[model samples]
Target: MSEQSNPIRSAIAEAIADNPTILFMKGTPEQPACGFSARTVAALQALGAPFAAVDILPDPRIRQELSEISNWPTIPQLFVKGELVGGCDIITEMYESGELAEVLGVEEATKASDPNVAPEGQPVQAAPLGIENRLR
Candidate 1:
């Protein structure tokens, strides 16, 4: 089915457009199901960026539709301002280089300079708004 005709695709696209920053990952930010997702979540948390997270695990179609929409065959996809910011490796690299903060439009948390450690504080959780599962 064409993207315009698919409800899942429409929902996924809407979710991306509606949320300024969103991560479609294997699990929730608090309990990421994969190492890549964990690392990605950590990077965003460390940067103190509030984003919306959608767990793609509840339904396989979520992942399939997300990947199709993103054109990125990866579980942990980060979208900033309705654009794909890439997966774990890209995020990690950007974090270490401080580019992620620039992309996220937040100050680079001092602790985030070290990829091994998260910022010292209660890691900012994903924002509640626009965080729905986006699946029927």
Candidate 2:
């Protein structure tokens, strides 16, 4: 089936469109399944950037559809404003350079001093089949 006609691809696209900031990763932000995903989550959390997370491990198809749509064959994919921002390495670089804060619209003063300190509160999680919830 064509990507446009694929339901999973359609849902993935919709999720990207719906959430200003979203991460399609191996596991939930609170419990990342891989180091790459964990680092990505930490970067966003340190910046106190509110984002929607979709755990792609529950279904292999989720990762497949997401990678197909993103054209980024990486587990931790970060999308901002419905555009692919990149994966862990890129995110880490951006975070270090303060570019991630700019991308996420995090104020200079709000950027956490310690990258290890995750912001308080639960990150929004997108449902596997029907992703719902915007960055709050």
Candidate 3:
């Protein structure tokens, strides 16, 4: 059957179009339910960029539909400007290389560089977001 007939596909498409920067992750940005998701969230947070996130945990169909539509067999999928940027590894690499900030149209902030804070730097840490395996 064509994907157009699937409501989940439509929802995923709508979400990507609606949000300039969105993540189809395992959980919310405040509490990602996976190590990959947490890392991805942290990378984005470090960039100080805003993003919308959808948790695929409530329904297995969401992840299935997302994979079918994105043609990417992974959660923590990132979309920027309605384009799939990839998952955790890609996001981390992009963050380290400053490509993520460029994609998000934000200035890259240096670690421990906030002038308002003391000389001792406070690292931007990903919240203690738990990790859940969906591949099983």
Candidate 4:
């Protein structure tokens, strides 16, 4: 079977269909293809749990298809159990705070930079408004 037609494709789709948290990235967790991808991967690693990673580089179709599925035009889009979480910028912001781990049901990563506060002398964290509570 072709890579696009492989059962693993559907299996990966189904696996992420209801996952609580997943990141569709350009490379594996161990090796990321871009800086944004790297940041997100590092954040996931900090969560210290097994999460799904889909390399969009292998197939051209998946990029289009995933965009259709999530309506997200970016690679590295995060899905919290089949639900669209956000893009890299949003995920990074959430990671700097303690929210991403809470939503993903994983322990927060140890950070040299505190999510409770910003490094550049920012005051109290602004409440994250658009972050939806998990559906599954």
Best by TM-score: 2
Please identify model 1 stretches exceeding 4 Å from their true place.
Answer: 1-5, 109-136
Measured on C-alpha atoms, candidate 4 has an lDDT of 0.63
State each model's CA lDDT, in order: 0.78, 0.80, 0.72, 0.63
**Rank by TM-score (best first):** 2, 1, 3, 4
lDDT of 1 by residue, 35-90 (tens): 89988888888877888888888778778888877889987999999999999999
TM match of model 4 to true structure: 0.69
Go through the candidates in order and give the C-alpha RMSD of each one to the true structure.
2.8, 4.4, 7.4, 11.2
lDDT of 2 at 58: 69
Residue 109, model 2, lDDT: 68
Q: Tell me model 2's lDDT, rounded to 2 decimals.
A: 0.80
Q: How do the residues 22-52 of candidate 3 rate in per-residue lDDT, one tens digit apiece? A: 8888877766688888888777766667677
The TM-score of candidate 1 is 0.83
Comparing 1 and 4 by TM-score, which wins? 1
Instruction: Give lDDT tens digits, candidate 2, residues 1-136.
Output: 7755676777788889888899898878888898899888888887778888888876777788888888999889999999999899999899999899899888856776565555667455544345422211
Worst 10 residues of 3 by lDDT: 127-136
User: Of the pair 3 and 4, which is ahead by TM-score?
Assistant: 3
Maximum-lDDT candidate: 2
